[model samples]
Target: MTAATGKKVLERRLPDERATARLGEDIAMALRTGDAIALVGDLGAGKTTLARGVIRAMADDVSLEVPSPTFTLVQSYETRVPLHHFDLYRLGSPSELDELGLDEMLASGAALIEWPERAGDRLPEDVVAVELTHDGEGRLARIAGSGQAYERIARSLAMRDFLTGAGRGEATRRYFTGDASARSYETVTMAGEETRVLMNSPRLVLGPPVRDGKPYAEIAHTAQSVTAFVAIGRALAGAGVSVPEIFADDLDRGFLLISHLGSEGFLDAEGRPVAERCAAAAQLLAAIHARQWPSRLEAAPGFFHDVPPFDRDAMLIEAELLVDWYVPYATARPAGEALRAGFRAAWNAAIDRLDRAEKSLVLRDFHSPNIIWRADRKGHDRLGVVDFQDALIGPSAYDVASLAMDARVSVPPEIEKTAVDAYVAARREHGGFDESSFAEAYAIMAAQRNSKILGIFVRLNERDGKPAYLKHLPRIRNYLERALAHPALAELRDFYRRNGLIGGTA
Candidate 1:
């Protein structure tokens, strides 16, 4: 089913609910080994209809009565890989999914689940998420997933769509088809050499905000910019930072596709302790910041407004949002006006202090999530650095703050300090800055940066409604407590203790 290189399209309208079911069946029939299809949409939104179509198309012997399973929980069918069709609508909690042994089934056969979002984190990381929307009598289906299995299914769907000319010559192009129904949108590929492609979505929420219905810049947010980032990645290669190479970037659609840097981020890996990891992280930061930039961002205005230190307002805005949106939500009455006031003072003081320090290039979001622990011949044991689309010319200590006081992962105090020292030593060895004051500035900035993170995490849960970030609040607060414990922050620490921050928001 693999094509060396060719474009294919397919299209068919689901005139009715039954037609949607038929479409699903066709998609299922095209599935190869290791396929998982997750159906998502509102109630009676044709998810079941599509699932039925897929089931019918895949196995001729299977029955057509694919009910919603609102009560039975999950109805298993015998097909290739023994397809398990789940209706989580009635399943009260995600843990109940484990009770049904869905994990084992996911490995052996295909799984079709309706209301998959209810399963949340339990769903397979690579499971296909198919969103079905009822448009008048027809249905619009959007499919997204990753892995070799989904890749095959995507290829098959695209082939079917191409054979049938489903959405050809339209304003948008069909990227793939399942059974008779095709899902298409504006897609741009970055590089043919690498499988990972940079893509852009002018309409995707993550896309930069639109003004007047047109994108911001003429070259604005295209595959080309992704390529530039990749070029930067290559430049940083062998220089201690282990960033993924950019294979392609499709700017028209705003996709900065690049190599997948493996799944063993600090969160997934059971490698070193927090301190050891932070130490390694600090070493990388040292190498990155110590290097000279060819041009200052202010000197080259239009090229990159995203790079750090140059765009102070945007960076400050991110921190301010954390304070404005996160603090009130994370803290209880214990964090009264005094405690809150102290926190603000610390942030402002640190920001002011660091704002005046000698500046260097900073990878703004240099935390655990951005790192990948991959194997290589380099003396270091793991790959590090990613999610650096917002790299900037700012305080060298900014990225260190991001690493030692990570929001997603905790670094031991001893380890954090050791990492700080290591960065200081490395910076001095590279020979450009004053060591004495840099140490003081590093501690102050670390505390301030982490305070901002605490606010950001709280805000992520309270404002964005993504509560998962709340789990890391304790670690962030830990960093804050330690940073405040410094003699320089004695007054801030006293204010916090009086207010209730010592033990965190209770």
Candidate 2:
């Protein structure tokens, strides 16, 4: 008989049970919603041990109880990625596979089948085959598949090679967290509790043209590569900001092994803002804005990243997200040309007023989520900043507004005032501060950021299949109302109120 026609994806020699478990951990990173991975071998092969590694990694618990389902025929786990371990050795009859509910399991999550031969032709067409065979002093494991599952495995394996070059080949990899964008993170842990972050921020693949034949990412000045993060991290560090140090990097491939900052944030147990930490974050922003920043930054000796200007066009494009996504979602109808015209006109006029405002390097997202609190550190160092890749030259007050009106949490009126008052007091101490101009800029910037967020949250839910952000809509609505109260936004406030976006009838 001819050998299997499937393309072999990976071949690795597992020298011991630890190496075998590590391979399973790598495989776990590639698992998707409907994947079927067949663990093939004889009875004494390390099939059950490999499956346990996958289960334990996904569950993020080293001692998770993952007993073989040989007697029970199947055992399900409620990990981050729901998984089912199927041992079909004693499957009795092929017809009994129906009761095993492979299809039903695949409909929700993925499955790991121990005896693929017993399932016969009932196995999925896209099944990934992992065969274990006895080697001279160890076991040889082979993985093969096609379609999305194969592509994912290929990507994960490539990352493993990258890790090997970075001297973390034997480290355990598990999901750390993910954000709204394509970027995801994994915590790579070496022996003896040394941990680092593996930032998998692939070069962006922009979407279809949204305006002027340019994708929204381009118009919005989104970071196209890991260079943005690298450049900005260095820039902040030089300015005395506490940003993570990049330990290793494959910039072209968009992979970075960075220091893991502590996990403490400004939010309390109930997800509410902590005033003291927020005030500290405010002081951090003031110190940042006190200095002048260059528009271009050197990421490496020769490689450079130009920090994009938050010009009128980019500001207009961001504000229109409210018109494009939030307006329709709110009114149950697409915004007409007249409404869009009114909205853009109001925003353009407000942006025109920004030139008179003080200028500095603005971290476009200076809210609570991106700020890591380090209580052990001293003044300004207490805030460990991350996610400043989209930093731009803009009004100095924008970051102050961001902390006062955090996008993720509800900063009550008193706490919001505390943040702003702290920032104002710090800027005054730094000298050459214009309180009146800063107030005007703060109101306009707050309103502008809220408008963009209102639309982005809706877009994330409808277009990106992320509904978790939708819950923040009401909180944003209130923040928008507060920002509109400033007399500087009288005209813009009128437009929003007319559309029932805020208070007052048209």
Candidate 3:
């Protein structure tokens, strides 16, 4: 099948209502705010059933009641991306849709319109259309779209292929919330089998070189491909660290079917850090740091990826995000070149201290969100680590700082101190552990990480249209203040105060 827009139309054979529901859920994964889906089918053709599937999937609640909108005209759902399920069959006329305010709804969220033909010429031109027909005991679905909607359709088809290749071709797919990055996830479930997570992390495209002929990703040592995740995952598993087991993978396409680590995280339901889980996570970090890390690790046979050192350049570039985005965002003016130069010099001087500190595999984001708490496992094995693709060879204290001063959840001062003490106590067993030097490094890294996060959250809101992250800015700012209290970061603290970036000091 194909569309007039020059894009291939995807066709699927849904054997039953279950299969139809799975199809809807898969489609939901590709949906973004403002996209419209037109469901075209005859009466009792499972149109409403499929629409319910999409609503439930987006809500991440399988049991969410999604009543047919046939009577209500339209049923709107408050999902991660707001959704409006419209049944236009009872509309008095095509012009009546204007009174329903659909354009306004689509501007803010997605719309799933059933019986779109009832609207006549009022239907959106760029909408994705799913045509359903009875195929013997099963149903046949043909999906077509144009523009961004077409791209989404293509990605959905790709996801289907990936799941089929992973031996879960007929499994139901449920949309999983995505993170700050371009990566996405889905929970795939097969009858009589344990659930698995589908990680859809496509290879990052390098933008026009912005720094020394390198893109921002390269300058910041961000993972450009899934090879890093595979390699680092294997390395962690080899060391007996609790990580999700990879069941299948398409490395080039950046798809992986891994074991689900349950939804229980290190933070409680109220968003406060759990003390026991936090201590375990710190101990896990100590165990990881105790191991001798290699410069290059094998991602696959004959494929080795060199672990890039978190050198002065990477540190300085990350800190520069403050001046690059946050400064202008907070001050309404860009930093002058002299200000930028001074900022760079100050960071360089502080980051230089990392050279003399102990180095290890630094899992850059070892916070509550990424750490899964496995009560069934023992000791460090109870912590299931995820999102380590950006791991680098850097100061051991970097990961500690990441854990102790997590960005996503509030870690009270006492809890943070306990975590720090737990990590230091664990490290002391290895002998020759200098707590003082480690504390200095932790403070420096904490300040750097928080500074980077402030800018990142602002960029997410201003540039990416995601304002939810801004809620954590004050928390991050507080962490930065605490870190600056250390005398070793006195100069950096003074610099921040001088620039009026933050107030007060140790």
Candidates 2 and 3 compared by lDDT, better number? 2
TM-score of 1: 0.57
* The 10-residue segment with the lowest total lDDT in model 2: 1-10
In candidate 1, stretches whose alpha carbon ends up further than 4 angstroms from where it belongs are 1-240, 267-277, 294-316, 330-347, 380-382, 491-499, 502-506
lDDT of each: 0.59, 0.88, 0.87
- Candidate 3: clashing pairs of residues: none
Local accuracy of candidate 3 as per-residue lDDT tens digits, 126-204: 8888989999999999887778876765777687888888778888777775899988888889889998899988888
Scanning candidate 1 in windows of ten residues, the lowest lDDT window is: 172-181
Predicted candidate 2 versus true structure: per-residue lDDT over 447-475, tens digit per residue: 99998999999999999767899999998
Q: Which ten residues in a row have the lowest lDDT in candidate 3?
A: 1-10
TM-score of each: 0.57, 0.92, 0.92
